[model samples]
Structures are given as C-alpha cells and as structure tokens.
Target: MSRFRKLSQSIWHCQYHIVWVPKYRYKVLQGAIAVEVENCIRAFSEQQKCEVIELNVQIDHVHLLVMVPPKVSISDYVGTLKGRTAIRVFNRFRKLKEKPYWGNRFWTRGYCVDTVGLDAEMIQKYVKYQQKKEQVAEQRDLFNR
Candidate 1:
C-alpha cells in the first residue's frame, strides 16, 4: 500500500519516532504489562486515525514509529497516548499505582519525539530491530547445536 494517507484536503506521510519510559525510569513493563501497553498504543493510534508502523515495548522504555496526520500535533498525540495508556494500565494493575508512582502516574513527564523523513525505513528498522536480531541469534545458536 502507499505510504501516504489521504484526507479531504490533503495527502500526507508524516511519521514520528517516539520513545518514553515509566516514572523514575522504572523497568516495570514486562510480560503481560508489555503486551497490554502494546495493545493500548494500537488502540490509541486507531482512535486518533494514526498508523503504527512499528512498536517495541521494552522493560524500561517504549519505541514507536507512527504515521500521524497533520491535524494532530506530536506533543498532543504523545501526551494523550501516555495519559490514556497510563490510566488503562494503572487501572488494570492496581498495585502499580501505589508507592513509587504517586499521583496515579505511570509514565514520566517527558518523552522524546523525532520526525521521520525520507529515511523512515531505516527509522522503522531501528524502532523494533531488537527482535529481529535476537531471532537471528537464536537461529545461529540452533545451527551450532
């Protein structure tokens, strides 16, 4: 399919590389929590008419490559994504909302966002490349065995 998306007024391809972590840089995301975060992000993207090109939820941080419409600002999108996902996660995992994570917050106050240009393919690769590398390593290990 074409990378560009069409609206009534414009045809555009705007991708962003966004990364954020839990409050205090905590590595609380894993297993079911990581899975839930991925689902929440996809749900959020769909709600905003955004496309998730790549998403990787790690123990400590999240990497997302998304094609966002021009009407939506990156900061606003990220803020909403963080806020909604935090609420969802915290609600589902009540124990997480207490103690170190005060104020019912899950993610940190800031996130890193960069616009993806013509090199979006490379950027997407970087977004979720760890899994490919690990799979290749596992294959090599199997061959050696």
Candidate 2:
C-alpha cells in the first residue's frame, strides 16, 4: 500500500520505524517541549527530503515512522535528527541545562530502526506496471510534438 518514489534511474519506497529515548530516560517531554520536538523533527525531515509518515512524542521517548530515500544513510539521518533537535530543544528550554546529563546529550547513544515493507509481489507488480506506463506516456508526448 506504500507509494513508490521515482528517480532518474530508480524507484524505491524505503521506510523505517525508529525509536529513541532521552538521556537517562527522563520524563521531560511534555507540553511545550513535546510540541517543539515534533516541530523540530518535521522541519529537519523536510530539509533532508525525508517524509515523516507518523510521529509520537512520549514523556521519555519518541517514535517516528519515516520514508527515506534509498540514497540516504539511515544512521546519518537519525544522528542528525537527534543532534539538531537536541540543540534546538536546549536552546528553547534553557532550564534543561540544569539536568545532569553527560556531555549535555539529549538522546541516548543507541536507537531502534525497523524497515517497513509492503508485500513483495505487490511492489514488484506495481513497479513492473509503472515502467510500462511511463514508456507509453513518453511515446505519446513524442507523437504530440
């Protein structure tokens, strides 16, 4: 049921469900902080050309289902998302500076990532059909010219 993205030479639908927690798993994400965290992730994902299919900000952790391009690195994306959001969150909530987190890191070192896949047969068939559709469209345009 997922949609595929077409590139010049590739078509892909790479998605992942990712989870991570705050340093020490503190229950600090609430109210303003929760909203800010969500906004920050959305903005960052847009800048990276990634799509956030779903997101949930809990008091101690976050769950994000994102659709990323095949060319992007999963580890790099998660790192950037966490690191940049941490800086922005800290800047907005200066009181958090008082927290005793080592090196002032917001999120923990490790995270969870799982791929989202549709039925293999369905994806193969869709891609196979898409190629033919594109070829027909190209031929039609040539005839119209």
Candidate 3:
C-alpha cells in the first residue's frame, strides 16, 4: 500500500463536511427549532465519539463539519446524525407537526461529504457562504413577491 494511505489508515482523523436538507425545503425550522437541531448534532457527535468543529443551521438545511474516527462510515454517520436530529427537533418543537417536518424520511436520501485537508478554512468558508447565499436568495424572493 502507498505510504500516505497506510499513514491515513493508521491515524484516524478525518474531517467530514455534510449537508442535509428537509424533505421539501420547508421553512418550518426557526428559532428554538434551530437550537434543538444543533443540540441533536452535538449528541450524535458524542455518540459516535466524533468532534463537531462547526455547524450552521438554516431555515431549510443544515451544514456540519465534524471530525470522526476512520472506523465510522460517512453514510452511517450522516444517517444517524440526520435521523436523530430530525426526531429530536420534531418532538421538542410543536411547529414541525407531523406533515412538514418529515415525510417518510427526515432527510433527503443523499448528502454531500467532503474530506478536509491541512487547510480546512476553505471548506469552512464554503459552508458559511452557502447559508449566506441562501439567505440572499430568500430575501430576493420575498422582495419579488
């Protein structure tokens, strides 16, 4: 095996950038709802023995940057994170109700995962920028209407 691959395999410190949107991009999450979601993320991180470096919760989507052990699969980690958060958020907040917070599934089927390198600032900025862009688009839509 390549030395780099061997070294990566030996030392498990992988930063994952994951994003999941609500089933229909509903504007159901607000205020305390966002806080609950953040809490859930932290809980999941603890459960998986991972560290959440940063998180950004928007009205319809969530962005998380976490450092996880190599044994954890990205798919499984994301599934658990999304599932746990959705359940906790819906349960704690009345606004979610039964219809909009989640359909058959809490999160969309797929998520984006990017592995971070020595310089993770770019990824952090990108995630932050995503939320800003969405806010801009939302404001534009409101004005247009």
Judging by lDDT against the true structure, name the best candidate: 1
What digit string (tens of lDDT, one per residue) describes model 2 on residues 51-142? 98777787778878788998889999999999999999999998898756636798899999878786434434443454356568889999
Model 2 RMSD vs true structure: 16.4
Q: Candidate 1: lDDT of 116?
A: 90
Question: What does the lDDT read for residue 101 in candidate 3?
Answer: 41
The digit string of per-residue lDDT tens for model 1 on 52-112 reads 9999997788999999999999998999999999988988888886676457678899999
lDDT of 3: 0.77
Error of 1 at 49 (Å): 0.3
lDDT of 3 at 73: 83
**TM-scores, one per candidate:** 0.86, 0.78, 0.77
**Model 1 clash pairs?**
none
Deviation in Å, model 1, residue 141 alpha carbon = 18
**Residue range with the least summed lDDT across 10 consecutive positions in model 2:** 119-128
Clashes of each: 0, 0, 0
- Alpha carbon deviation, residue 50, candidate 3 (Å): 0.7
Superior by lDDT: candidate 1 or candidate 2: 1
